[model samples]
Target chain A: MKIKTDKIKKISKSSFTIYGMVIMAYVIMQILVSTGSLSSLMEGLLVPLCIYVILAVSLNLTVGILGELSLGHAGFMCVGAFTGAFFSVATVDLITIPLLRFGIAIILGALAAAVFGIILGIPVLRLRGDYLAIVTLAFGEIIKNFVNVIYIGTDKNGFHFSMKDAVALKLEEGGKVIINGAQGITGTPNDSTFTIGIILIIIILFVILNLVNSRAGRAIMAIRDNRIAAESIGINITKYKLMAFTISASMAGVAGVLYAHNLSTLTALPKNFGYNMSIMILVFVVLGGIGNVGGSIIAAVLLTLLPELLRGLNDYRMLIYAIVLIVMMIFNSSPKAIELREKYSLKRLFTKKTKGEDA
Target chain B: MALLDVKNLGISFGGLRAVDSFHIEVEKGQLYGLIGPNGAGKTTVFNMLTGVYQPGDGKITLDGNDITGKRTIDINRAGIARTFQNIRLFKELTVMDNVKVGLHEHYKYSTIAGILRLPSYYKKEKEMNEKALELLKVFDLDKEKDFLASNLPYGKQRKLEIARALATNPKLLLLDEPAAGMNPNETKELMDTIRFVRDEFDMTILLIEHDMKLVAGICEKLTVLNFGQVLAEGNTAEVLKNPQVITAYLGE
Candidate 1:
């Protein structure tokens, strides 16, 4: 469906033009995939790339849009990932076709994440921004730990099957639950194709794009910019904050499920959904400029790829990466980067003007 | 019946009583002003009335309904919308979006509509845009609808705040210093705009202003608050001349 032009036009003209460029980039990606020259590592990176893009953009919904720091995003991700994996692993043989199993698993995973998101969102949402962030972060840890303690050995019939028996039963036979615990669930059907991941990313991007442009989304942003003002003007700060938090979590859950199944593992390691993951997502939002959805997606892709590109640094890899992060943080806080960006953009604008005159 | 009836409302912070035994009533469609010198508890009165603070002892009734201790959103939903004393516009959002935020109370589409991109959502959304544009146009701000609220000039920002509150479709609008930082010319324009909004919205307004001239010019009735108590309450002319009000303003 065509986006309402009025809202689209309301964004800066440069941003509106950039939207076209993004679409073209997506099209070129599709062409590259069909041509099949993209390397295996690049192809492998695509799913995580899409997943992180969604996580970063969605997390920004709460952190950036509602002006609340939500560190508990990974917790919601854990919930959704496990829930989806639980379903797909439990019902793998129930659906004969691999394609159908993949489709259902992803959808179920997203829905599972959304459900848990609402559950987690309601309680801590009443807190102020800093408190909300901390509470959410704790929650992610809780979810991660909770999964480890959960008993996943019993089948739907309540029969506790041994790991060997469960494996022999075949995924199609409605056998035992697959998430084995800290050891990790193996033999997870890898249905997360680049096509599916990209499609999901596009859907998330469009949804967030529409939402931030919509009236409700603006209300959330309003609450973010000046909560007291938003409240005074009859906008309920808590309600909008909760909406953003839950929505962000739900999308993160979607990403988490993609990640779990794509990797064909279901280990509920606390480290997997730990504080570092949350910070990584936050860095994506902050580096991109908090409220800019397109920028968030771009940052997510770049950050996800950065470490991989830095792999050649060998022993100095993490040290150099740490230096880069410190530099980014230093530049970020003081508006120097913003000033430079503006100056650069001005030059581009003037060049475009000169080009127009020449034409 | 009074549109808003606040009786004996008070709030205490530790041993200090911020608002004590304050009472006021506004008849439907009347423009009432609450004014006092600095630290006169005018804002505290507004705060208690709007459910920002639960009164230690008091009752607030709106249109014969008890709204005492209700949450701010509940109060808003029950037809009381207010602006803050500190100008709190959503700084980063555009001017049109700011007004649209006010219209959020009227947005009926569910999250399902949002996720699915339903036609009903689009229809409702389009209607909201038209209404937001109309509201902005009323205040002569439609041209700058895309500009961030913080980017607007001080007077325009004040106007935007009022526009946003108006979007909530409140029966009783509380404006906490609508003319706080305005120059004489801007304040005059604000006075006219306030009057226009009151008449156009068919709303009862209870505004807190320190400017006596504005209180006298725009408010049909005035309540003079001193030390969390109503020092005087009557029609504007009478209250402005009251000895207690003069002392509260002049500080004997």
Candidate 2:
């Protein structure tokens, strides 16, 4: 029966075209880079560019799909990065022990990030839009600050701030050793490459895409559009919002891990995980068009490379950014774009229909 | 037995009783219309029935199942569907997508399956799409399947809301002022559509409407409220002629 069903499906065709297209895109990207036509700046931006695309798209699941604005998205990313980085460093010496060490670390990092996402999502999700955003923003700041105060090792006054020494101190403090205060965890193993980062980003992107198209996702969108109506229709608004938040944060965590391993250092500083980074990531979504995954990726990659392209005009770069954003917002928000898009699509649709009938 | 039974359902906001000792019992397959002047607590009764507010005192039952004080979603899951007076749609989504949302309960594929694009997810998704399209077609909305809901005109938007509610396969559909802003022609068309939906879906309906002619035309039974209490309840024609309902509407 299964064989017969499979055969029948193959005969009619399916969305195999989408998968084929995805493969073609990857091939095209690789070819562009390898042929040197993509430019060094664009190439250098690709890895972080891909990661940000995943982050922005995933955040959209919370902000757009779930219809709840989140301002502390980077906090989840931080959790993933630190966890992934810690695992990689701890298992660097065990590289000769086959895939067990590296593989385990990646899985552990992703899981740790997911767990933290759940923990953080539960409390703040009760609040409405602006309140939720503010709470999440505060939570991110708190997490960064908390990491800063972690005392990893003690120097020489009987105990010091050190990862090496924390192993022993943990035994006495009942496994409560601090990593170190504000110094950031140094000597992190640099194991993340473009391949792994891109792969994980793809995985996260696929997850987010699926979620937004799911029953749960539709419920979230309904709440965003009309909360009262959604409630009247029997959608568990709170549950779905929290689910979106947690899933988004988990994806951010995966990106964080990739970021930490790529950067080869963890700085428990406000500057590293600041509000600026959060806004920069959000700009990708807004510029790309909210609830649009493809647009988000395009925007992330383009925006990531924009600064590099304007590196020569460093003094006036920010001013240019502001102007571009303002212009885009003015054009995007007005009914003109919507009207134009509708007309264009309608025209195209009729033309296609007429052509098909004529043939 | 009453399909929806509400007893002593009252809600107080600070000093005033917004809805006081409101009571209603709607039988199966009943086309019940609730009418009242502004602040007469018609909508408040609907709210309490659907779990928007926990009544100061009340009990509600559906099919002999006690569902008092359940969350809105929980009450909905128990086979009650409702539409707002102000048409509420997923504005950014397509009309077909909006209908698909109402068919959410049927999609059983997990998030993992959906993300991985597993065969089951694909199959379920295909089925869902078909169902959504079918729903749109039922309401003459198939032509506007891809149009963003907010772009739909007023009358069509109202039709879309009813279509969406019916997609839930509800046992009892509640429409809160479905014809508030509609023209006479639209209302006439709507009266026909409401009857068609009720007969086709074999569902009971509770509607809150202010238009006496429209209410008297379609609703088999009527419940009139005045100042948070049931002023009149009987067959539509009989109840409309009642002195209490007349006095309440005339501000006597």
TM-score of chain B of 1: 0.97
Q: Could you give the fnat of all candidates in order?
A: 0.48, 0.57
Q: Which stretches of candidate 2 lie over 4 Å from their true place?
A: A1-44, A97-103, A152-180, A344-359
Best-matching candidate per lDDT: 1
Alpha carbon deviation, residue B131, candidate 2 (Å): 3.7
Candidate 2 TM-score to native: 0.87
Model 1 scores a TM of: 0.88
The candidate that achieves the highest DockQ relative to the unseen native structure: 2
- State how far residue A110 of model 1 sits from its true place (Å): 1.9
lDDT of candidate 2 at residue B113, scale 0 to 100: 76
DockQ, per-model, please?
Answer: 0.40, 0.46
C-alpha root-mean-square deviation, candidate 1 = 4.7
Give lDDT tens digits, candidate 2, residues A1-359.
12232212431232233234345657788999888799776666666766787788787777767777778877777777777766665556546542355456667766776787677677767665577788778877887877766565432333344433344454443232325455566666666666666677667666665565566767778888888777766677777777777788878877777677666568756555766667777888787767666667677777877778778776775576678789779877788875565456423211111111111
